[model samples]
Target: MGSAGVRLGRLKANTSALFVCDIQEKFRGLIHGMPAVVDTASRLVRSAEVLEIPVFVTEQYPKALGNTVAELALPPKALVFEKTKFSMCTSDVDKAFRKMNLDGIGQVLLCGIETHVCVLQTVLDLVEKHNVEVHVCVDGVSSQRETDRSVALRRLQGLPNVFLCTSEMAMFQLAGDSKHPKFKQISALAKEKRPDQLSAL
Candidate 1:
């Protein structure tokens, strides 16, 4: 339920958190569209910081997969956790979510690597178990193979409480409109498009 406790068709700043999963060094050159994925993830992180939304990040088996890529520039306040499981739904994460839920956070904005694996599993746990509204950023998550990534996204689309969107779409949904206090900052973010995303003008 959202504003009127009927449909969750919007995202409120007070009810949102950002989740970045397994965008690590080991998979750098292995994942398809890695550059774009990192770009969108970075943008989302910056937006989350500006919007004062708590950030949750998980590194899958970091000892072997290595750490989150340096380019992501996670802030000092963002919760970064290490996990051996493919899903980011660890005890620690659940604890944090529980705390946030108490404070009215029921929406999750997710972006990260290996869409078919960690991202998919985490989405399942979030919707099925946590019972929170999940927004998966399409441009922000991917796998080594386009087919895997596409299939995972398609499956995720069908799941209840799971919303698929681009990074910018989530940002605007949070801000709501031009009158939002942080609208200017979000507009600036929307303008700074990556080269690949920019078209000839």
Candidate 2:
């Protein structure tokens, strides 16, 4: 839980956005549970579209790492940025946020690869520099080693502005209730199984 005065509340579709980071073709073989990460990230992207939430994606050095995985169904209007920076909070990313008119966004939902490196750095930067609440999809993030992912998650959990969650939890929270228009679609998406590697998380 966050500090009592912090007011870290549930995600509101209108005030939240999704950021997919560095889940590229190059790491498909290197990262553990790549399939699960792609699947969960895809589900989140689709759910975001259904809920009319904005989505942004970052590819770390696309020339070397390749583009985002084809399995993931990125929304047509999603903003895509290619960057060399490990932390995605670069000027280019900032420009994209500005272009998208994201000044009102309060929370960012994050999903993607190498949890210990790029993902961790981006989460810290978003919370400290941007002053926005960050929620990580545990099942949608990973590293080459399980230990790296576990350690990174443990470290991130200690941050007051960083909220750790699963893809299903985020989807439901964003939907708010069973009566939400997208509830049935989100519910179906949640029923899909993630890799066994994410089972313990």
Candidate 3:
């Protein structure tokens, strides 16, 4: 419910990126709502593509865990960064981040699987070291246990530069306009699974 106001100056196309942490095979079945996570991430990727914003993804040891889930259908333009480290702020990872021109990125809108560990660690690192604003969409990330997910969200909300939001809020912010041509397409992606409305889209 708490929010660190969006940094409009740095939230522009070039100053923000979406980091999708291990929403891969080995971890998919273990999360609270796998399908919803896939849908939300898919919608995010679609929005990012329409807006021409950079999207970054991480695969945690894909050889053992497997690739990102099939439902996501990540954009080919997206940057897929491989890493073994839990925290992406480590020397090598940070270098990759810098190479992406993320040093100027003031806000990082994050969404992915496994909210309690990898997502939490990455958010803290981005806030503490990179001094980047962190906004995590609650509905887009989850843990196998609700209690752990709740605890992690509470801790993230207390941080200096972090915001916890629902998937709708994040998507609308990125959309910036209902008149945008891709609005219906992006909206369709967001509403893909609502039983009553799915057919309409």
**Top of the candidates by lDDT:** 1
Q: Which 10 successive residues of model 1 have the least lDDT summed?
A: 192-201
Model 3 deviation from the true structure expressed as Cα RMSD, one decimal place: 4.9
* Model 2, global lDDT: 0.86
**Candidate 3 local lDDT, 1-201, one digit each (tens):** 135754432244556688888888897668777776777777777778877777778888899999988877888888787778876556765766676654565667888867878899999888777777788877677778777777888888778778777656776666667897667866776676632111100
lDDT of 3 at 179: 92
Per-residue accuracy of model 2 over 31-115 as CA lDDT, tens digit each: 8988888888999999999999999899999999899998777889888999989987789887766554456887899999889
Q: TM-score of each candidate?
A: 0.93, 0.92, 0.83
What residue pairs are clashing in model 2?
Answer: none
Model 1, position 5, has a per-residue lDDT of: 68
lDDT of 1 by residue, 145-191 (tens): 88888889989988888888888888899888899888999889888
Report the lDDT of model 3 for residue 130.
Answer: 77
Query: RMSD of model 1, in Å?
Result: 3.1
Best by TM-score: 1
How far off is residue 118 in model 1, in Å?
0.6
- Candidate 3: residue 183 lDDT (0-100): 75
